[model samples]
Target: MAVGAAQYVRAMHTVAVLALDHVIPFDLSVPIETFGRTRLPDGRDAYRVVVCAPSPGEEVATGAFTLRAPYGLDALRTADTVVVPGTATPLAPLPAPVLEALREVAARGTRIASICTGAFPLAATGLLDGLRATTHWAAAALLAETYPAVEVDPDVLHVDNGQLLTSAGAAAGLDLCLHLVRRDYGSAVAADAARLSVMPLEREGGQAQFIVAPWPATPRGAELEPLLAWLEAHLDEEVTVERMARQAGTSTRTLIRHFKEQTGTTPLRWLHRARVRRGQHLLETTGYSVERIAGQVGFGSAGAFRERFKRTTGVSPQGYRRAFGGAGAA
Candidate 1:
């Protein structure tokens, strides 16, 4: 007599997440939340996300909490996609088992990803050698120095090197997730996911916004501080270049030089970015009409606001608001 056997069919997008000691709970969970939350337009799940570890039923210590992974390294062997999140205990080298799994998965045409400093593990595998990648801005320098073969850029929120993708940090991971959805299913599915999650359709800007309103790492002298604060608080004001120069107690030429030196950009450019950010905040967080948000953010009127917003963010203000707004039914 033959024993009855059960076979499991793998999902097309099998996402395997590596859970190690001292895992960042939030980063590690992002893949599970976003990918698991998604479904195909046909009402089927888009991906299967599994959290796996070295051995079956292994326990992992996540700094603040202890968790058990029901699956083993075998899960990585057949995964269509693998994701690595930053670990709290990354000072140590990756475990041999984990490294082996990464090597095995990647050799089979599986796409590998890193969220934030997860690049560390991937870089160690040498797959990212000579590939353009990025991590959190705070780690870009370290990543470059640590893995000379990887081209690291800290400016953008993330970088997509085809099958390999890396994100800046926590929230940037969300952007990368949505980007993957857009790539796989087109903008419609991704937009629906954004709507379901109650998140912005897309991020307004890059990780550069993480810098700040007017200050860089090295603080400027007290003279420019008050002016920047004023500009931030009152973006609606008619902030002319001449006015900024006067407020900084310098000529426009001198102000331009100082602004470039301090912020790596002209005052005008910086102010434009700030206003766009403000406009985005208003759009997402308020129920105000587009015209009202435009005026409130110093756009002078809705049409001008649309033009400048599209120029800066590549989408019209109304579109941006529609995407980001916790809006009532259209």
Candidate 2:
């Protein structure tokens, strides 16, 4: 099965979720619930999700409770995609049999993904050695320390390296699964799945948005909260550092400092990202032309909008729309 293939080929895509011992219950349930509930336009199921374990019928402890999986490692052989949920003992050595099974599945061109610290076991198979991967921010340092060959990015909600994918902690798993759904079935179907899951089709930012940082002693950092909301509401306006400073009641230098401390980005860069995010939503949900969307997002011209949109999203406006836009997109 090809990645992002046409909808027909994905009608019955098999997704095998590997539930190891001590698997986080939430992580294990994400794919099952997301894929299991997804329906095609004709009312057919999008994916067939199955829970498999290293040993079938054996009780696996999940902290909250112990349950028996109906399938074993052999289930992976027939799956088009395999998902590994996070485990409590992420740093513990993986059993050689499990590692060998994962490697064999990868060699057969099966797509694999990990949720949270599940990246630890996936890394143990050496498939992620040269790829960019992510995990729960709390365990990022340990993951990097343990697997120096794997490039660990602690900021993004998820990293998709074509065949191998990894997501940040907890709810970020939902983002990754929704992304996969979008890839397989386009935006409209994915949007329906997102609605069923009670999650936004796409989150505005990455896991970095969830990271907590120490605030400065001054009240300036707290003041930016309202300014951030103001920026979102005025994304279509021509925003400038001086304008943001005025809105925040601070000097440009002070505003810049506070933006970096609070949001980890410059004010202008944040505005650009905000515009792109808005542009993405418009493209997905509206019948607006690129030129129209460019202006709506505050770009001076369609040409500049195309450049910045591609720079931030790795695809031209048309390309993104083609992949994720709704039927109404023009």
User: Each candidate's root-mean-square deviation in Å?
Assistant: 7.1, 11.0
Please give the clash total of every predicted structure, in order.
0, 0
Q: What are the lDDT scores of the predictions, listed in order?
A: 0.78, 0.86
Where model 1 places Cα greater than 4 Å from the true spot, the runs are 1-11, 212-330
Candidate number achieving the greatest lDDT relative to the actual structure: 2
Off by over 4 Å in 2: 1-11, 213-330
- Residue 66's lDDT within candidate 2 is 98
Candidate 2 positional error at 36, Å: 0.6
Which 10-residue window of candidate 1 scores lowest in summed lDDT? 1-10
Model 1: per-residue Cα lDDT over 143-194, one tens digit each = 7768878987666778898888988888888888888888887888888877
Minimum summed lDDT over a 10-residue window in model 2 is located at 211-220
